[model samples]
Target chain A: MPTSFPPPTGDAEAEDTLSTLGEFGLIARLNAGRAQPAGTLLGPGDDAAVVAAPDERVVACTDVLVEGVHFRLDWSAPDQVGRKAAAANLADIAAMGAVPTALLVGLACSRDTPVETLTALVDGLWAEAGVVGVGVVGGDVAASPTLVLSVTALGTLEGRAPVTRAGARPGDVLAICGRVGWSAAGLAVLARGFRSPVAVVGAHRVPDPPYAAGPQAAKAGATSMIDISDGLIADLGHVARASGVLLDVRSRAFDVPARLVDVGAALGVDPLQWVLTGGEDHALAATFSGPLPEGWTEIGTVRAGDPAVLVDGRPYEGPPAGWDHFTR
Target chain B: MPTSFPPPTGDAEAEDTLSTLGEFGLIARLNAGRAQPAGTLLGPGDDAAVVAAPDERVVACTDVLVEGVHFRLDWSAPDQVGRKAAAANLADIAAMGAVPTALLVGLACSRDTPVETLTALVDGLWAEAGVVGVGVVGGDVAASPTLVLSVTALGTLEGRAPVTRAGARPGDVLAICGRVGWSAAGLAVLARGFRSPVAVVGAHRVPDPPYAAGPQAAKAGATSMIDISDGLIADLGHVARASGVLLDVRSRAFDVPARLVDVGAALGVDPLQWVLTGGEDHALAATFSGPLPEGWTEIGTVRAGDPAVLVDGRPYEGPPAGWDHFTR
Candidate 1:
């Protein structure tokens, strides 16, 4: 356990601190007495840490969540930011059909930021990491205008071959392992100034990717895989382009979650559009050679044609535009 | 080769251009036709990249270099920033006595940023990764106020037990594998609004850690190890505290790097102070149980005493503090 410093209460009082503590002193305070996992041979005190990978193959991915661009403090708490950062990275590892083993986080925030906020952030990170059975091995914290989190996840294949986007064959069947469009719908609810249930807002804050379903799909012979981070059509297009096969989705086959439908109905929007084009759902999208695996629902099929993703045998006419950091 | 939209020639640019390009299109552009080194079984354009960790044990570390806090765009080029980011993360992996194998980067920048700048940044990243025979296997790109680079490095241990910071014992000989204080000197020069030789400024731009020396020290029986990212005294203090030993340094051992001496002379500062308290040199400092390893110079000793670093039997005070992201 790390030594805890009491956080400032209420946002009313302005504090003139941080410079008094200094960076090294604060780092010492933050890194104090945290326990490292058994597989970690070296931890925070060193320049780098060594961990046992066991399977000789490591699955690696990176994601950056920026302030205002990815999330707003007014909408989410510090703990939520930390949880979201870890969740996004871990989802990428799961998408590769690997078990997440460790994580590294890079944080940049303004000076005068409360150390309590940081501790809360770390608590959120640890909370999510605990759920996934991974550890936060190392990180760097610095000052910036707004909070920025760069998370990298490392995973072990456990002797299984990695499922990549390019392995889908022309005749493979398409399946999804988790909920789709909930985050997007949640975002819509937030944007419209509607107070949603804690569960709905929680989905928007820290997405719950179906972590167990990834390795299960790999074991069930998934040919190609990807995380639905950039909407179903957009992410599947990566599979199509990489595998050199067109993917034709039968929209009726998709099993949209009831929560998403409820939110969409209450918010007065097409839930199907969110299912097709809304991103950050982080569900696993994969192609299988045989019958759909447990907890997976068949949604489409890989077709022999030029690489593309089509809805009901036609190009998606409604925006197809997913999240773009720079232009949007 | 990524599809290049005609490079921005004028100042005014259309908004929503990023949204128009879409997330998948941007990722496709970013990942198109990039070559990766061997051992990267699956590279970008996948859910997660797969790298061969061969040794079953891997070294990993991450750091975020934020604009203004970690770097200044007015002072350093985008390529320089890219190289520095890679060097810092790779040095962390190397400091663990592991050979770096791959890197994952996460970048967040504004939409108005030029694509040429992004390409040059990547060019510099590749240039530096080539030095240690490692290549970038994966990354993420998003939008933010200023540029934020988060890099994670992976390395192989090659059957050697990692040299951690907690293993330094009394009577262990302390040695260094690379130059120290050059970066600090360069930073001082930069801060002073003065220019020196290309080498001085170059040190500030791209740090050169002695990559080969890490594994060599491990082979020679290093007991504890860390990278000189912080000033020598400050970083050694970490070893002292972790290992419960006192570290005493003799400054005469730093005669090999004439640049350190020249920069100190030019700046009218004590060269010894820079050697002791300057940082970001990426040098490896390790404690050895036997004679110093090949390519390592004996600079200090671990002794049974209070956990502190002393120079010539006294605590050395200096003008410059070690590099810190916040509260500095």
Candidate 2:
């Protein structure tokens, strides 16, 4: 059913708040105009979705974003929030060497929220879902004081083995499949009101990861993999700890994206800090046993040593430690 | 590291709340003493978790619960919230006729939240996850003004076809696994502050569904199925609408538990209403083409007619309508 709050008219009395849209109305609006993938046996209308994991295995991950903590309403449009939420969760599925297939969203919003905001969030979710040929299979909605989103993504491996963070071994080549520090730069621009770097600020608001590179790396025999939710150094530390091997990252070899380099110059900030300590870039970092796949850039190596991450054979020194949800 | 604020110890300075706990302390407390299931290749300590889904197919579902709406903190313990969150998500997986494999939780809590509250919440999550033979895989923690939990459940089909809500056909038998209405009864007792005949209030706080029944139904070739999350008649209506068949439930044939009958008598509310319209029971309701497997009770039959649900071919009059997150 076309459940949605009527758009507000010039009359102040016609204000369309979330209470007017209600939970079901907002969901109905969200579900409208969405397309399901070919393999989705069941979609949003059911209690749960049945997806075809033909390869006999599935990759799954979840992430939660809270307004003010993860994003600000003044800085991020509802659409951007929706896209970022989906992006963050999907990155994890990709890190496991799988193709994302479906997503389930859990939303909590205040009754005073605008209908347009809710619709924008759904549109963003659908827009991103379409990019990966995935569907928003199901979700839960409830009332809260501020907006909150929890997204869970499910993916298919097409019979490939999962490339976990623990698979890195000494001598494995470390590589990356997307840009680094772009999101951190964007966040910096947003926080500092650097109007000249609007694009960077937007990137910080909504990250776009190279999803296909996950399976590509798997096909190329990636030994260990991780999505960069935390800064590169911090994330690599996870691989080091899990694999019981030392990871040495070569920052100088990272062919920094020209756009980010230009933005860093304009903002008068250290781009390396963004690359090494910025989080939410969602780039795929993995240790491969063979030649790197196309589009994959080799940046480091795994070594026989204590579980730790180092730069040029020593612990990397940067702008303090990377972000921690609680510490921050 | 322990992230959340420490619990209050009745010391004069024990008033430190979630805000004092901040983000990190809350995470540390919530994660304390939790163990991972054997199937988990990687657990909560990482950016994402890897779990076995050897059936080549997975069933996934998610749901979010909000404070002061889904549950009241003043009324329910933090542990209850945690259990209910996991239970509801796992129930959705069960409804898909799959065995739950893992869970990923997302939490947003107020800054004033006490570390002890978060610990209790995590303990509840573990307790419920243990019931379904799964473990908490991974999660995201953030700061918010209210307690919000978003849980996603992953399930394995074990080489069996997934039973969708659309597979019911004319002449199929409708059956139920496990007791229903106990949760509803518990809710009523809690709401009215009335004495309960059994531990029904506990059931309301933490539902214990027949977890194994879902996969068993899949193995036995159930045509259609769904969990009773939103009252029986309302949920069956979904199956009828999806499967294009009418479901005629024979109320007289219902094999309700003795505790419910006793509680209904003590509360002076009709036991049938609780059975028919009570939600959150998390019981599996399925339609089979033939005789049901052992331990299942036949409750109704599918017939060709308008897509509707009836008790003995007539409208089921009850005080409770189905449960809807948005509308309710």
lDDT of 2 by residue, B159-259 (tens): 77778899999999999997788889998888887645448988888788888888888889899989998889888988999999999999998867788
TM-score, each model?
0.93, 0.88
Cα error, candidate 1, residue A187 (Å): 0.5
lDDT of each: 0.81, 0.82
Question: In model 2, which runs have C-alpha deviations exceeding 4 angstroms?
Answer: A1-26, A169-173, A194-196, A254-268, A288-291, A298-305, A312-317, B1-38, B194-198, B219-221, B254-268
TM-score of chain A of each: 0.91, 0.93
Alpha-carbon deviation at B327 in model 1, angstroms: 2.4
- TM-score for predicted model 1 compared with the true structure: 0.93
Clashes in each model (backbone N, CA, C under 3 Å)? 2, 20
TM-score of chain A of 1: 0.91
Q: Residue B23: error of model 2 in Å?
A: 6.6
- Per-residue lDDT for A1-328 in model 2, tens only? 2244454556433356556655555677678777788878777877777777776666677788888888887888889889989998888888888888888888888877766787788788877888898888888778887789988888877777788888999999998988789889888777777654666777887898988998889888999999998789888888998899999988787877777888788778778888888889799999988899999888888999999998877887767646666556
